[model samples]
Target: MKEKLLTKEDLAEDHKKAVRGNTKTTREDWLAEAQRVLIEEGVDRVKVDRLANKLNVTRGGFYWFFKNRQDLLDILLANWKDSKNDPLTHTLKGKNKTPLDPLVRFIFTTIRERSYSPALDSAMRDWARTSNKTRRAVDLVDNRRISVLAKVYQGLGYEEEEAFIRARIQYFHQVGYYAMGVHESHEQRLHYLPIYFKQLTGFDLPKEALQGFMEE
Candidate 1:
């Protein structure tokens, strides 16, 4: 008896089915899964073998999609930024059910909404000591977020420099709160929202309506 070999056409068909199932995946699928894995398990577990285990595939399977682990991590970093602002991100160039308001409530809502992206960002930052690419991507995401908040400050009638300063302070506060152990009902973060925002921007976010404070 002779060993049989698969034709290119047969392999392609198998890959097509794999792509649809997210079991065996394409490069983009690997990127998305890498990002998701990092957010859930951190970088140490984002290795090819582990991802294969997590996805119930084989280690050889990842090489089919990514050049290497570093390449996968890089993709995760890039995707993290896109995930941050795509839904209920604090930054706004367009409309959202909730735009910027009391810094505290808005920050909590964002945490609740975009939980994975921020967790991935934190995981990447912690691992940056070992990876240059991760460090640079983290720096870029932080700066872009600052820029977005600065724009929001300007809309609220602050001078550019003042807006920039307020945005900086607000960012720092939110980072702390995100990592803190503050439990609240849906009403809790919202109820205390004014206190935190007043402390940061010298204005409390009105709970009922945002005051459209920036509306002319």
Candidate 2:
């Protein structure tokens, strides 16, 4: 997943189709499953026949929703980026969140949840190195999200560059933690998430940062 190889026109068109679901199929649900596959399995693993089998639907059923595998991926990335990010935006708008602390929570909470697939994370890391188109898309997606994050951080007094750099480092931190998280239990891994996140960004990540969210 991670915004691997795709064209802008292709992404826009696919985004439209997913957003405009008709009665012939449940476009959102199908796209949700596709996103799960991409996030959990990698962009290349979004096989039409396999998805068809997994959904207990026919290949024809999938075709009704997507023109092909590429189309499915385009929609999946668009939707995931759109949906998974709403909560972060909400936190940004609310007065309750602390400077940079919400950002750390967004990063480490994803690690705690295993939101992205290990298989897919590896694929995209390699893909970004070799595929020009994919690297560009990755850059766009990464920068686009970071830019929004930068805005939030700047409001808290970080200069623009500082905010972006913080977002970038924290982004990589979440990805790295996800790739290596299998070694620990959920509670154990989450225990150090706040401090580890702060270290990545060279920021004053709040001590007892997550105290309110945890139960004794």
Candidate 3:
């Protein structure tokens, strides 16, 4: 029998299969898996071999992207800090074209969309209990969040003292809800959102904005 050569189409199809079988994992993939482990199993469980096994890939995949385990952990911490602060800063820096704009944006973005991670937040707080470095990171995130929230209230015509207090009330309420594992569905919480906003700011959030949250 004569030797046979593959056609271009056959070669291309083989290449596709090879690529599909060995999917390229990025730094985000490793970080995401590590974060999941950190949240579920705590920081001690975020080791490279452990994560690699969980991700169903060899440790080489992790080493290729990270200098070492500490480097990967540092990146994860940085991501947590950004995830905590950025969205709050963005949402609170509102033009407030309407009386309810800032409050509505803050509620919608922070509460409903929940752009940050509660599990990660709780995990980080637990980690902070032992590590001063982690504690400082948590402090920075908390201070920035509360300060920005205070500024939002100040913008809503609250005095500096009242603004800070109201900010604490709102922020602490949220932290307590997460800490206590209180679960309220959107439907259950819907009627109370505007009421909470009003009590927090001493001003009614517009009916339209209230409706927006209810509809969700």
The candidate that achieves the highest TM-score relative to the unseen native structure: 3
Which residue pairs clash within candidate 3? none
Each candidate structure's TM-score, on Cα atoms with residue i matched to residue i, is 0.71, 0.63, 0.83
What candidate 3 gets wrong by more than 4 Å, as runs, is 1-20, 83-85
lDDT of 1 by residue, 30-125 (tens): 676777777677777777756656665545546556567877766666666563544324434445454344343445546455432446556777
Ranking of predictions according to TM-score = 3, 1, 2
lDDT of 3 by residue, 19-133 (tens): 2246866677889998888889998888877876776665655655777787988888887777444676677775878655766787777566576567778999988997788
1 or 2, greater by TM-score: 1
For residue 185, what is the lDDT in candidate 1?
75
TM value for model 1: 0.71
Local distance difference test, per candidate?
0.62, 0.60, 0.75
Q: Which pairs of residues collide in candidate 1?
A: none
Error of 3 at 1 (Å): 58
Give Cα distance to truth, residue 112, candidate 1, Å: 3.4
* Each model's Cα RMSD: 6.7, 8.3, 9.1
Q: Model 3: C-alpha RMSD to truth?
A: 9.1
Q: What TM-score, to 2 decimals, does candidate 2 have?
A: 0.63
